[model samples]
Target: MFESVMWLIVVAGGPLLLALLMAYVLMTRRHRGPAERMESDRATKRLYSQDER
Candidate 1:
């Protein structure tokens, strides 16, 4: 009985814990600021412009 209970906890709780952890990480992540975004856009544009040459 104890082994069965442990198995149940491991099977159910493992995914639950992983999902909660993933949610927390996704929710708490910081987005890039405007200056960083502009720099990224410029770099992308530069790369594409070079490809057109």
Candidate 2:
């Protein structure tokens, strides 16, 4: 039936979609190490500043 085929497509594509998302995140993160670290440091600074205000 059409519903079964649609369900099969959804089930079959789930892992492939997840793998693609993981790969994309990993690839982008490889070039963003310094930027991500800086963001974390800035966030920490803001947290401490807010406490002092």
Q: Name the candidate that leads on TM-score.
A: 1
Clashing pairs in 2: none
Model 1 TM-score, 2 decimals: 0.70
lDDT (Cα, tens digit) per residue for candidate 1, span 1-53:
99999999999999999999999999999999999999999999999999999
Q: Which candidate is the best by lDDT?
A: 1
Write the residue-wise lDDT of candidate 2 on 1-53 in tens digits.
99999999899889889999999998887555888999989999999999999
Count of clashing pairs, candidate 1: 0
lDDT of 2: 0.91
Minimum summed lDDT over a 10-residue window in model 2 is located at 26-35
Residue 4's lDDT within candidate 2 is 98
Please identify model 2 stretches exceeding 4 Å from their true place.
Answer: 31-53
TM-score of each: 0.70, 0.50
